[model samples]
Target: MAQLTVDIIRARVEEDWTRIVEVLNRKIALQSISAKGITAEHMKRSAEFVAEQLREVGVDANVVQSHNPDGTPGAWEVTGSKIVDPGAPTVLLYAHHDVQPVPDESAWRTDPFVGTEIDGRLYGRGAADDGGGIAIHCGALKALGDELGVNIKVFIEGEEEMGSPSFIPFIESHRDEFAADVIIVADSGNWSADIPSLTTSLRGNTDIDVTIKALEHPVHSGQFGGPILDANTLAAILIASMYDANGDLAVPGIVAEDPIGGLQRDLDEATVREDSGALASYRFAGTGSLAARMWTKPSVTVIGFDAHPVEGSFNVISPQTTFRLSLRTSPNQRPEEAQEALAAFLVEHAPFGAEVSVKRGENGMGWAMDPNAEATKDALAAMQEAFGVTPINKGEGGSIPFIPELQRIFPAAQVLVTGPEDPKANAHSPNESISLPGLKNNVITEALLLAKLAQ
Candidate 1:
């Protein structure tokens, strides 16, 4: 492999800027929303589009399909490779080709399917969330060309927006084909447009459904309301037990904090409140810095509830009620264990001897990467050089289940999560975008990291 400096990589990425935008725009034009109404052929087209770009950059790419749990056809997956040397370390790049459903087209300033550039940022449905990711991989490969020192593998799935139901089966069926020594997941966002970041940790998630039954059937509220509270009231008690007066998760056996030092930086309360769209008078929950509460601590939210609506006069006492609990565990805790603990808590805390039943939903494990590893140092240096600023390690409050699954399947591989999306990217919402300069910098950073691994 020929030695390449960061300066040369930056210059090459700059030269390919126009082509990168063109590719991103073309990708944006394809509405690959993997939802209920979308068809298999529609998804296959997006996968083939990505494969075509990879092939153009000298990668042996193909659009493949994985199976669902019932042995039915699942979402399309694009897998490809560029092996420079059998002896060199292989790096796997991951990003999704599908996007979230646009709930309201009228909210968009520009057409969601047409990539628009305004004040140096490209706006579109998939621009930053993941289309930017595809551009990064192809741009880096194109810029480095024959100078790319390490082996490269690309896995761009078409079902990430739908929770990647086929991810486990897909990976298990082709474990060897996706093997690598290093993995870069370009699905997360940086701190800001100018500040680069690497996501070192992610909170795992588990969902549980609980039903509380107080009566066999509905009875007149006037007769049963006083002696026995309605099932909905009993359900409220169970939900309130999840938190203490401090608003911390009241469950036991679930890890609460990082156990190491928490976030390196704390978020401003006002800024977080404004960004989250919380009412000014709404007091924040949980104890500790906003960053720790959001990134490292455990949280339980009642995502769904079943009860009588307030639209009509309800003169009868409800017999049963059900609610769904979405639990976000600490970065280092196992979601299965947390789920068990939560189930036990709900059963034990059933108020007024209400008959409670807990049903386990799905779970995804969390992840925490070693920040001092050799590849991590290289990545940090690459980001520093590309962005001309010090890089920070960040922890995402949300779960990217597939990432930890990849780490579990390939225990020897180093997983690094970084991307061009910023806080203003508005991913999954109206006016989604990516900074053009940030996109170029990410390409240069990835190219430099690929080169640094060679040495």
Candidate 2:
């Protein structure tokens, strides 16, 4: 990698750090949770707010309203630009402004919507998953100013955490706006707080909302206990069949690949246990090394269940049990294919004449980029330059559905996936925070890359 002057850029980023924090704080305070009745007006307000920050960074920015496939209001996006030369290659910086709902607000250390800094980390629901992401872009662009090399396009998505249900239509509606030679996605994470990682592969995701009915209404346990196939019991049986005795997903038809790519990492038991927060006595599930099963294999998890809690004692049996199934597919598979296979498996295995129905939800394809691509080459070099170390290349277990879709949309462009989260960052879970120093360094890295890409 050739050396270029980034000292000024570094100092400039430092100068903007305080304002960046304020942006993150303001963004975190917005309860832009999409799944709930959080109105489109509120979501649009956040998008417009982000556009304000980008304009401060010298980007030509605007708030764009879009609609769903059914023609209803969709994600309100903030699109911005800072084009140095029309002939120069373009880099699209991507991050989402929307966030997940605080399911267990009581578990949070601070108000989940209030961004608080404690012990060097910013804690908030969207701090890392995205509020921090937006701040990073704003800081980097602010530092670069008019001298930024590449043609820049900044896109802040509105409904990413809601599985981006309306994303496909939105992107299609404005395809030319997002056209670029390279895309920098700020939704991924570093391998560790200290070790920077370039994610070359991402897992795909699918969801199924299933309801199992054994009876039309709750039945008395005393009168019909003996041979009763309660909905709850039937649902349990169906879920149990998803995994084999070895605790691996037993479903057929889902694709699996050998975790032997150039970017694969060897994650040992200690690393898995540390990241998972599993108890010391707990044993791992699935065959092969933890990394192989996690990064290169398919897995099924029943994410949400609509049933009675164990806290209250009940004599009546549930008539129907509903569950939200979340399945992670390997990079070798498409999400739609996996979703179809999973739905069939559930229906075929319904126990004891139980009426089973599966409702499929939005699904996304996984992405795997060529490590040999020139943009990949430039990015790896830029990461090493910014972080002052050779970045570790690895595949991530989490799904960023848009990456593969972007690839499908613009096959010629290179997509560099990077982020500020670590194992301790705890993105979706409670106590979620973005590492401050790590965030700053990532900004520097991206700023340097933007400068390099311009050349």
Per-prediction TM-score: 0.96, 0.83
TM value for model 2 = 0.83
Mark the regions of model 1 whose C-alpha exceeds 4 Å error after superposition. Answer: 1-3, 36-39, 259-262
lDDT of 2: 0.83
* Residues 326-444, model 2: lDDT tens digits: 98899869899999999999999999879899999988788886777777777777677667777877787778777888888888888888887877888888999988888888888
List clash counts for every candidate, in order. Answer: 0, 0
Instruction: Name model 2 segments beyond 4 Å from true.
Output: 1-3, 35-41, 103-106, 111-114, 207-245, 274-277, 303-325, 340-362
Cα error, residue 127 of model 2, in Å, equals: 2.3
Clash pairs, candidate 1, are none
Encode model 1's per-residue lDDT on 150-174: one tens digit a residue.
9998899989999888888988888
What does the lDDT come to for candidate 1? 0.89
Model 2: per-residue Cα lDDT at residue 302: 80
